[model samples]
Target: MSLRVQQMLGYTLLSAAFFIGFFHRFAPATFAEPIARTFDVGSTALGGLASMQFWVYTLMQIPAGVIVDRYGIRVPASVGTALVGIGAAVLALAPSFALAMCGPALVGFGMSIVFVSVMKNNAIWFTGQRFGFITGCTLLTAAMGSIASEAPAALLLRISAWQPIFLALSVLSLILAALLASFWRPPPAEDCGQLTARNKKERTKIFGTIRSVIARPQIWLIMLAISGTNGTFYAFAGLWGTPLLVHSFGFERDTAALAMTLSLVPYGLGSLFLGQISDKLRTRKAFIIAASGASTVAWVWLVSAGSATPVVAWICFVLLGLSSSQVVASFAAVKESVPDEATGTALSLVNMGVFLTTAIVQFGYGWLVASAGTGSTITGDLYRIALWLPAAISIAGLLGALKVSETFPREQHQNQPANTQMAIRGQLQPPYRDGD
Candidate 1:
């Protein structure tokens, strides 16, 4: 096959894996009632079950990044995809709650590697200018999976039990894993020769590279910004949004899911366009700051609009998803903030912030809701109190956006042939110069 064909096939398969990861990520929210009924668990336990995935995913980010940096995408991506399949099958057959918990944890561990692999592949197969757009497309694809897990999955639940659905997911994931292993090819050596060489040379100093990535203030700021915006979105749309709507606003389950779908649809669409716009504008920080500000405003509106009408709630959800969609820009910013060789590490670090905050918010929200009461006893006022957590985090994200350095224009200007040669030889510092 031609290189272009190979790139297309490889990226497609990787995206398929990413899609499955996203489906599982949000599936619990759609099936929260059924899962709770099956296990006779309360809000806190369900939250813990869902948060299990984020916790494991959070812990695995650095290791996943290191493995991707060292071995490239093929072996790790294939194995990780298979693990997700196994986890789903485990969830399908689990005889008890504890065993079922293991399923999400395994899925989390498996999924932790997929995003870094996709981002690393994008860096290798595409040029720098298109990176933001490609990342946006990747997220757009992920949003489809999120959508599938929500409204469609809820509609399916009317006719079938959740177990059979997960079994089908398990089979699909396994097949995708097999295809990824068989057909996913790397970019041509000429395209990635320097990156491969750098990986080899840095293998012995992996810890040093990680430390350097961690030491960068820009990376930390990007992490805070993303954690606040995307983290809040995930905690809600991925798990709590539907429940809040159904229990608090008196919407039916399917209608609540449809509302979540509305949020995700815009989120996906916004990711696609906002990424392209960020690239065209040749700016990252501006979009990040704007997104953070918007997210903060949406949270405030949602919290203050007590017992909001369905239409008002829908507007807030849409705003939340759209504002958070600028997360694609944040990932691009992280990639641009570090050296090309350390891209995976930097991306992983920022990604860790997202899941870490997500896990906390998911668990914390559950704890807050559970503390107030249980099933049907939980009130809109209680949900409102829990929401302030994410709202405060969004404010922190806005602050981080303000502090993060502008990277796109500076990196574009510095990545000339001579600068590339210098970068390859480790003669230049990272492109994060102040006042760029």
Candidate 2:
């Protein structure tokens, strides 16, 4: 195959891997109540089990990146996929709550590696200008997976128990793992090559690289935005959005699911569209600021307006989906800011920020809802609370965007290595200048 074909195929397979992995993490979302009832536990206990998965994923992101940096993408991606399969199998067979929780935690561990590996590989294969678009496309698949967890997931639960759903997912993960093993090869060993060190000296340098990324003040701000925005959305979308619709609007479960699905369908589309816009404009920061600002305003209106405006709520949620592309900006920023050699590590740092915040947000939202007492039916209030949390967090990201100067430092700074510039701009030489 031609190189372009190879890259496209690679992107396709990786996108598939991401889609399956994300679906596995999120597909069980609507089944929270079913799992709780099966285990005879309170909502808090059930949520805590799910939260454990996020916590592990969050904590492992940086290390997962390090593994990718030291080794290559194959081992981490392949092994992680196997782990997800194993976790799924375990969850499917679990006869107890404790055993069930183990499944998700294992899945989380495996998933952590998969996410970072895919992103790291993308950095090597794709251009900086395309990062936002590719990130959006990849995430669009992820969002589709989440949507599967939402509406179709609800339907699947009615067809069979959660066991079957997870078992099928496990099989899918294994298949994808095998496909990746067969097809996915890292770039030639000489392209900035994999970070290799013979002994302690190299390890220390790696450690130092990580420390440098961590010490940057703006990384924390970016992290805050990524985590807060993603966490709040995941918290509400995965666990609470449907419930909110049902209780607040007096809709049936299916109707609620439909509403949530409609709201989310636009998420991927918006990301795809806006990602292109960001690339064309050559300014991801402005896009991030605009998206976040819109989300904040839209969500505030959601909380204050209430049932008097269902259409308005729909509009606001769709707007939220569009704005959620701030993540693409974060991804672009991290890739652009760091040394090419540290791409994986830098991204891992950002992932740690995003997932950790997501865990906290989801857990906090769950705690708040649980505290409202059982079966009181306060979905509207729950959503409103969750919306406000993200809105506030997104503002931080918007502010952080103002501080970031480049989306692709080498290109923007006119300092790209010849090979990299050729690969990125699809030409062997920079645009000519008269003097040079």
Candidate 3:
């Protein structure tokens, strides 16, 4: 194959894994009611079930990064995809809630590696200038999975049992894994020699890279911003949003699923748009701030309106999805903040932040609802109360966005010595050029 065709094929395989991961990530939202009915659980328990994957995914991020950095993408990607397939099957066949819980945990563990591997793959195959755009494309692909998990999954649930649907997903995941193993190839060893030599010269150990990435304040700020925005989005759209609409706003399950699908469409499109725009403008911080600010405002509008205005609620959902697209810029900023060899680690750190916040928000929202003692008849007021947590999180993220240093136009660090690069990385607020 020609080089371009090869790159496209490899990227396609990697994106397939991401698509599966995202499908599992959000499938619980559509399945929540059925699963709860099957397990005889309340909102708190259901929330725990939904959040389980994220918790496992969050904890595995660093290890996944290390594995990708050390072993390269093919092995990890194929193995992770296969594991997801198994987990899905396990969940499909589970006879007990406890066993079903194991399914998400295993799926989360497998999915934890897929994204970092894809990010590393992009870094290897694509140019730095197109990084943001490519990352956006990756997210856009994953968003299709989210979209499928909503309306399509709901529709499927209408005709078929959830078990059969998940069994089908399991089969699909296994097929994708097989394709990955058969086709995915890393760059030629000779092609990577120079980059490896550079890293060796720097004596860049994995632990040292981890420490360096962790010590950078910009990474934390980026994490906070992501946690507040995208994390909140995941908390809602991934699980609670549909239920809130169904119980609180008097939406049918199918209609609620469609609404979440609408939100996800903008999220995917907005990521692509923001990635290209940020790349063209050569800016990241401004987009981050804008997205976080918009998300906070949307949350406030949602909480205050309290299902009294369905139109307002619909607008807030769409706005929240669009604003959460800041992740395209956020991931780009994180990539730019670190060295090439540390890309996987740095990206994993930021990703961990997203899932960690998501796990907390998902469970917390459920806990609040359960605490109200409303049982199956949770009221709009109770949901409004629970929503305040995410809104507060959005405000914190907005504040963090303000402190995130600009990372575009990375020319200044290109020619610097290794020591100078390290010094620059440590600076909390690097000086910016005019127009930055």
Candidate 4:
């Protein structure tokens, strides 16, 4: 195949890997009842089972970034895809819930690197202008996976059991992994992030690189902002959104699934829409600020609108989805702030917040709901209490957007140093132009 064709195929295969991970990430939401039944567990136990993915995923973030940086994307991405397939298969065939929890944990370990790898590859393969747009497009694609996990997945459960569905997903993941392994060969060793240092030296280099990234004050802000805004949204969308609908508005499982799916539609569109708009306008803070503020408003409205009507809830979900799109801005913002060499590390740092928060809140929120002592028939008051959390956290996004330095750094060809691209274990590159 031609180079362009190869790139396209590589991108597509990676996208498939991402889709599987995304689907599996949220699969537990719809599978809650069946999995609980099969495993003989209640809400607290079930939350632990489901949040296992995020916990392992959170633990793997820095390591994933380091590995991708030291080894590059192709092999890690392939391994990740295979691991997801293996995890899915484990989940499909497992006889017990405790055993099944191992599946998502393994899957999380595998998929932890995917988002960083994709971002790293994009930095190498595409221009800065195209990066934001492509990132949005990828999220749009993953949102499809999210939708599949909800409505279509709920539809599939009607025909066959959840075990069969995940079994099929396992086969699909392996197929994609094989394709990624065979078809994708990146450029020479020099252009990629994979390092060549000896064991002791490489270890020193790895820690140093991460240290530099952590040393930056703004990374924490970006992490907090994203954790609060987009990160919080992800927390809800992955686990709580469907149940909230079911309990609060008296929707059935299928109807709640559909509503959750509809809620995700705007997030996909928002990612694509905000990415293009931010790229075109050459601005990040404004879009992020607007998105964060708007998402908070929309989510709070959702709390009150619980009694208004389902249509109002749907509209709020859509609005929240659109606002959540500003998350791409955080990725873009962090990427621009740091040097190219640390791109994977920086992006992973922020990405870590999303899943870490999800894991923490997911496990915690389950009990929070259970503690209301309502037992299954959870009230609107409980729903409001649960749903209000993400809204409060999202304020961090607005604050981080303001505090982080503006690096109109998308025009990567401009002030970026050639030596910096060629340098590793070196001081960070200057991202700004010669100005005030």
Tell me the tens digit of each residue's lDDT in model 1 across 145-258. Answer: 999999899889999999999998889888988988898888766777676677778877788888888887888999999988899999999999987787766778778889
Q: How many backbone clashes does candidate 2 have?
A: 1
Worst 10 residues of 4 by lDDT: 191-200
How would you order the candidates by lDDT, starting with the best? 1, 3, 4, 2
For model 3, the stretches where C-alpha displacement exceeds 4 angstroms are 189-193, 199-204, 374-377, 409-436
Which TM-score value belongs to model 1?
A: 0.94
Q: Estimate each model's TM-score.
A: 0.94, 0.87, 0.92, 0.90
Candidate 4, number of clashes: 1
In Å, residue 296's CA in model 1 sits off its true spot by: 0.2
Name the regions of candidate 2 deviating beyond 4 angstroms.
189-204, 372-387, 412-436
Q: Which candidate is the best by lDDT?
A: 1
Evaluation by TM-score, superior candidate among 3 and 4: 3
What is the per-residue lDDT of model 3 for residues 59-124, given as tens digits with 9 covering 90 to 100? 999999988877778899988998898999998899888898999998999999888989988887
Worst 10 residues of 2 by lDDT: 427-436
Top candidate when judged by TM-score against the true structure: 1
Superposed model 4: Cα runs more than 4 Å off: 188-204, 374-377, 410-436
lDDT of each: 0.86, 0.71, 0.85, 0.77
* Clashing residue pairs, backbone N/CA/C < 3 A, model 1: none
Q: Candidate 2 vs candidate 3: which has greater lDDT?
A: 3
Scanning candidate 3 in windows of ten residues, the lowest lDDT window is: 426-435
Candidate 1 weakest ten by summed lDDT: 423-432
Error of 3 at 131 (Å): 0.6
